[model samples]
Target: MSENNHAYTLSDGTSILDLPKVSLHDHLDGGLRPATIIELGSEIGLELPASDADALGAWFAEKSNSGSLVEYLKTFDLTTAVMQTSAGLERVAREFVQDLGADGVVYGEIRWAPEQHLGSGLSLDQTVEAVQSGIEQGIADVRAAGRPIRVGQLVTAMRHNDRGLEIAELAVRHRDNGVVGFDIAGPEAGFLPSKHRAAFDYLATEFFPATVHAGEADGLDSIRSALLDGRALRLGHGVRIAEDIVIERQDDENTYVTLGTLAQWVKDREIALETSPTSNLQTGAIAAWGDELIDHPFDLLYQLGFRVTVNTDNRLMSGTTLTRELSILADAFAYDRTDLEVFQLNAAASAFLPLEEREELADIISAGFEGS
Candidate 1:
């Protein structure tokens, strides 16, 4: 679909930015404010490509949209470079939550690899605790400001690294504090979840939830490993699972399709697909299907009854918010308030929260949609 200048508004003029939303796959390190990055970089004696915040923001956007994952990841190196200390981590995490609250996210799961943040001699446990402290502070600040926001930590293990088990243990240790689940992120092509099978097995044995970054930079095999080996409850940017679906016929109102075994399992089991529209387009995650947002398999997966949820995988890198993502999707797919509510319901159902809290979130979403 053609990009619309006024993409994020409802036909009747409802502002998408005002809608209560849930973010499932956002990265803590990838959502830092440009000004924060500059200040933190300066504090650490690190020279940035751009001395100014706006210029640095533009630089991040440019590198991310360059159609290369390697280049896109290089931007993270800068962000993480400033996040090695407790103060840096705490401030960034707090700001991340505040930004999410401002973006109308009622709840968000912030994922980051603790191992990557240990360059400052902080232990893994210390890093997780620091982030949790920041998250708690952010929540208190949001509540103090009369806004209701809840955030959870999705402790991540870099798939290429050998500390998966250590990270998994760390996530489990903090489960009662702020950690809600475990995840494996990083280069998704060669670093299969199977490589971290020991960690996944350990998490499974402990009954901890896990999500895997699959089907983005990789294909169905990677997704298969995530589900089978990683026991992923959700697929991080699982946009490529569409590759397994065979579209047989299409009419103006209906499309007939056949699903492969993997797609069938993911759909029938209600596995959540965390689809980030702008990030997917920028990273070429949906390139095989098409280049535009409208070409994304999100609609296809949703139509087939897969638990598809909208997300901002990396807000800073993508230069987007969840509101903008949903707005663009609404414009591209002709979605309405009902459609948006359904997405929220799907996300609420798939949240790592307890059943009662998930129900509460669903109720909140229903009430909000009805009021709108």
Candidate 2:
């Protein structure tokens, strides 16, 4: 888990890590290599909780595993501490893409709040440019190794902050550069997407895509706000949308259920639910149903035809990869190769890329799954 690249397998003896995948919910600050964090901490003269790489990574896991929201979020303070300067941001971004490439990700959208990185006086544009440069370098590095990766930035605005309009503008400004779409991360309970209606309105006018972090820390109301106010094309860990579904009864013949208006909208509209299995458990996002992977509503959503996509919300904190996430789900639900391929295809379709590129991604995924 300390190393971002980890091999996974299915019961059928297929190499999960070798399959082409798409990542739409990964965080740039959450996927840093422990070694990189240690080195960057030293350069910035920032005091770290742990001096060694292993210990530092362990510290992150420990904090994130505490199940307390406040404690879980404190881990980011350390990761973002060293990511203030341009060089640090660029380096971390470079390594992030490289790690994703190693994990067999053909396309990924890394999300991070540029507003948080302004502590070191780097302008918002500079931070975006630095990360884009790193991503390009990482792509080149992967190509040099005879593999190719395509990555884009999901410029994020902290939902709890009032910088939504500014960040939204920044994302639109960099639309042609490397920024592919926009997102709203951070605390989601009290800070609903409606709080940033103006920003979403502007994005709608500009016809930009967005994916809001809803139904993770909050419930149906938050998801409603995401669709109605944020105009989210996808739901960032929209796992809690399951809350709106009422199971009337279950039997050998049938399992009866009813979907609330909100749930029906999300499901029928095919809004992608970026469900992160491990992160959901660690963050208490799935505590309502149960405390294990088997209890996740991912299978239910997929069976019900929601555009369910597998993702690693925070790789370092959750100690997982896209490969590992798929494997975990496969084991929990007894999913087969076709099931895993459906998840990949769902992600490819949900990607914020142009329709043609998304179709290209779908073709790549279909071919890979078929070849396997």
Candidate 3:
């Protein structure tokens, strides 16, 4: 489906695209506009797979759909290539927020590694500042257009790199400016959260919040490390936690299951699972179960009482949005508007905002759904 198309809907025919939403796992580098990529590539003398916006977008979808993590990641080399300078970062960040607003996202956390943007001699702090300035401009532009939207930064460190502590400190340093949280991205299999012990320890000492990318490409052990070592307040696309679940039986009336300790902890603690349906399929995050969306453990996790929040891990790569993700899940699981609202509430509660602010967001979501 085209990125502009709505992939799911409410029972009463309400467009899922019109519903208020919260995007928790969106990546700043993973969501560049195709036209913007072409323009930025022209400015930087970078080669693109396709010169036209639609064809370039289709190229991203094809690469991401290859079911190879390496192939999926190769697409980002092109995106980050155009995002080295301050102007590039600011423009991309601004467009990211504007796109999220256009897709009915009321609040979002845009995560990206500053280290990746320093190829042009910009400091890590300068990169963060540029992105934040762009985010502010995007917010102003959205407000001027009579749309209400809010965005925060989740400064990310490369899990495969040795600068976790430095990045964690950078995130904390800008907590009041625009950064709201810390995260670790990149290869997730061998580079466990325990590898970044000193960084997590420093973040703990500073009482800073973190959300680790675990249980996506990796399994239960990585999730355990995220909680025990990283002290993660949330799990980024922790969809693989379903590996810990054992399904006993299923009938028309009921499905019986058992949960392992790790799954139980995630359920009891309500650590938000940033489940991205299309991205999960593309990255093989849900390959243990099946290839289709219905085969995804998202419904199983939700039924098992995990705090499941729908997300679009990479909008451009997956050819998706928060609205499209929700729509696809609803279509797969036969979910109604109430189920969709529950997912939004789950995300709002798990957001890194103050409790009162989260409550306000919940109120907005509730009102929006009610009006719909």
Candidate 4:
């Protein structure tokens, strides 16, 4: 409501946070409250960069803006460190949903690698249960507060590790519980999705959905592998798909463009691009395009008919929310509420939920935008 507390407002004096949104590629370990991290870190006797919340938040932002994906990922080490136990995982997951609900997110997919949370002697199943319990509690909390929100876990496997097959199975095992999809995160350039072909193959056989982290730290080839090898239903930060598009000619009246085979396939298939504006800028994912948000190819991809969805990949690290990400895009591209609503609908359509459920989410979003 108030600008002091909310991250964004439109020119019409509308709080962007009041709009219903869908988050397709949000990270669980990356959205913890600073205070929660401090408390959890203390309980585990873990050393933190800053003992206080504000300072710790600043530390995360600073590290994330280092313009290196690898360095940006280092910030997660601290967050995941505190989330090594059931209590820690539950609290983090609970707060994650509460924060999403507060941000006006009607539905969100919280992605985190379970392989990274085993430091406290917890099995993969136990970790999944802990997070699911937190998610249920968080949903109840939001409903009690007169807000309706839905969330699903995108159980992730670190790409650099060899536990992809294991993590994939864990996700499928919990499909009926809270896990809705699977994802592969970590270094993207060298570790192609093909490296986890076995896992993707298994997921394919089981008819499970997956979204691969691609075209952020790498290029078209990586994306190619993600589609062919990972069988990804969506591309996490697939902004770099722009690289495959060539502007053949530009004049005052028109800009002629051509899409490469890879780009053509992606656009034709309507694979969603989980582009996080702030996080992309912070990690230099859009560096090839340009330095500032205005230079991001998100608009190009959007205009070119890509199923682009807005996201806060790492809310805490980027110091952003879904509202803030949309506001930034609106500011840079002069988008209206209709444009914002389309992004939400895109996310809803691309969600790993069943067709009827996705349609329901789309209806909810369309209704909200109409009322607004």
TM-score of each: 0.97, 0.98, 0.98, 0.98
Please say which candidate is ahead in TM-score: 2 or 3.
3
Q: In angstroms, what RMSD does candidate 2 have relative to the true structure?
A: 1.3
Worst 10 residues of 1 by lDDT: 1-10
Per-candidate local distance difference test: 0.90, 0.90, 0.92, 0.92
Candidate 2, residues 114-135, lDDT tens digits: the string is: 9999899999999999999999
Question: Clash pairs of candidate 4?
Answer: none
- Model 1 CA deviation exceeding 4 Å by range: 1-7
Candidate 1, RMSD to the unseen true structure = 2.4
Off by over 4 Å in 2: 2-7
Instruction: Write the candidate numbers in order of decreasing lDDT.
Output: 3, 4, 2, 1
> Each candidate: how many clashes?
0, 0, 0, 0
Mind giving the per-residue lDDT tens digits that candidate 1 earns over 85-134? Answer: 99999999999998888777888899999999989999998999899899
RMSD of 4: 1.4
- Candidate 1 clashing pairs? none
List the lowest-lDDT window of 10 residues for candidate 3: 1-10
lDDT (Cα, tens digit) per residue for candidate 4, span 1-372: 113436477777667888999999889999999999999888878899898888888889988999999999989988999899999999999989998898898999999999898987999999999999999999999888988799999999999999999999999999999999999999997999999999999999999999999999999999999999999889999999999999999899776899999999999999999999999999899998799999999988888789999999998999888898999899999998989999999999999999999999999999988877
- Candidate 1 displacement at residue 99 in angstroms: 0.5
